[model samples]
Target: MPPETPPRIFAPDRRAAVRRRMLNLQQAPDAPRYLLDDMIEDVVERLAFLRHRPQRALLVGDIHGSLQAALEATGAQVTTVEPALGFQEEAPYPFSGFDLVASLGTLDTVNDLPGALIHCRQALEPGGLFIASFPAAGSLPVLRSVMLAADADRPAARIHPLVDVRAGAQLLQRTGFTDPVADARHLAVAFRSFGREIADLRAQGLTNVLADAGPPLGKAALERAIDAFSAASKDGRTVERFEILTLSGWRR
Candidate 1:
């Protein structure tokens, strides 16, 4: 029998569109890059701590080009495959034999995450490293509460189901990665209003890309959501927390 088809939780086209839009916006002088910058810094720090120096590296989903520049500064030749160039995380990659592979802010949305992980592992030369970071479980609690209030009678799936650290470790081990490690970091950001939070999400290309996303909230529902969001604020500002899950492994 043929292999079973994976459930399509996210739309590839929508993902591509949002990522492309994000890349375009990243070119702007005032793009919101806190999340991306944080992830990049963490990855670089991990590389330094591990004492893993890559002669050739493959970087995925770096919209700002900062990560590539950092990798290059380490004397590693970096090759980037970004969504703006039609790179799909779930799809098979063409090139291989790299000492390091780093995927930032993209793997969480892939339908076939295990397959993607396998590909990342296979692309590495022996003993190569694989690192990825994305918003994971327990993220966006404030926005989630607002959305739930908005859909009072019928709460819709406004947020993507995220992977926790345990699952990340299991996925790495299942995909034949050795010495797998997974951890979470929380980032607290303050927003003056719900609309500003939404805007930040869009700027980071972290908006909903679910294939079966529900219809937009009606005026009354939107108002309720905004009000609920405001009600949860303190001193005219709401604090939202994002849990970034980082996964690392090495190919045997």
Candidate 2:
């Protein structure tokens, strides 16, 4: 057997963070997490526009279960890989069986993203479709700026490294997927306060998970970062831009 793959970037504890945050969202549906889910739904809607409805569908990383319900509404049987229940450690992966596989905000934090894409492709039948959307390169520049300003003297690794649009397409093709297409869409999430934005990030399970992250910001630094973020606001409100990159392909 090959040696265990060492994590390159994201911390192992991030898996636990993902589990906890997602569970809280399910238990309390008060936050506007659905707005973000719109990005994932857009990928599916693109497939639907092509009339690529599936008879058997799989949804990986469903944050609120709404995506699964929406897919089922089209009369497709759906299987959701809920993070809180664990990462399908015991489920059988029947190769070439699923007609469609869609994932939402899942790939960004994963350690073995390439292997994950391979698995996703393997699970698809001949000519089946796979679409995944995650935070890619050119995302969250404003947050990075704030993090740097917070610690201009000693910066801790606050953000995880992410893939960009072109690199994203290469991975799909490298995984032996066909006709790979990738694109980026911009979203400017408005926030009245930096703290509320942090809360929203927590609500969506998007937080610092770098394996080599130095340490959490000191109280003073944290306060300074918050101030910096707020100060960068336009017209008394902060607008954070996120480049939602979507990658799509079909099995050859």
Candidate 3:
């Protein structure tokens, strides 16, 4: 029997559009970059701590260009594939033979995440390192509650589903990676209004890319959501939490 097809939960075109929007926004002086910066810092630290120096590196979905710069600074030749340039994570990579593969903030929306992970593993040379960081489960509790309140009797799918650390570890193991490791970290940001929080999500390409996302909320629902968000705030600001999951493994 043929292999089963992965469910089409995310829209590839929507993913590309959001990523392109993010790339455009990142060129502005006041773009929100905390999430990407935090992920990049963690990846760099992991590389340093592991003492694994890559002579050639492949970077996936690095919107800010900081990861490429850092890898180049380490004397590693970096090749970047960006969503803005029509790079699809679920598709087969055109090149291989890299000692390091670092994917940032893009894996969560792929429909065939396991296939994508397998592709990354296949692209690596023997003993190559693969590291990926993305928003994990348990993120955005405040926003989730507000969205639910907005929908009232009918809760809409406003947020994309996320993978947890345990699932990430299992994926690495299933994809033929050795010494797989998975961990999570939380980052909290205070938002004075719901609009500001939405803006941050848009700037980071963290907005909903689900294929079946519900229509825009009506004005009354929007107002209710805003009010609910405000009601949950403390000190005139609502604190939203993001759980970032990082997965690392070595190609045996």
lDDT of 2 by residue, 1-252 (tens): 995784777765666676577567657748757435767668667876878988898887776677777778889898877555566422345544898988788777767777878888888888889988877787778788988998888887887788888899888888888989999887778888878888878777777777777687889988988899888898988988788889899997
Residue 160, candidate 2: how far off, in angstroms? Answer: 1.1
| TM-score winner between candidates 1 and 3 | 3
**Model 3 alpha-carbon drift over 4 Å, by segment:** none
**Candidate 3 per-residue lDDT over residues 1-252, each given as its tens digit:** 999999999998888899888888888999999999999999999999999999999999787679999989979999999866878677778999999999999899999999999999989999899999999999999999999999999999899899999999999999889999999999999999999999999999999899999989999999999999999999999999999999999998
Candidate 1 stretches greater than 4 Å from native? none
| Superior by lDDT: candidate 1 or candidate 2 | 1
TM-score comparison, 2 vs 3, better candidate: 3
TM-score of each: 0.98, 0.91, 0.98
User: What digit string (tens of lDDT, one per residue) describes model 1 on residues 89-154?
Assistant: 776788999999999999999999999999998899998999999999999999999999999999
Scored by CA lDDT, what does every candidate get? Answer: 0.91, 0.78, 0.93
Model 1 TM-score relative to the real fold: 0.98
Q: Which candidate tops TM-score?
A: 3
Specify the poorest-scoring 10-residue window by lDDT in model 3: 83-92
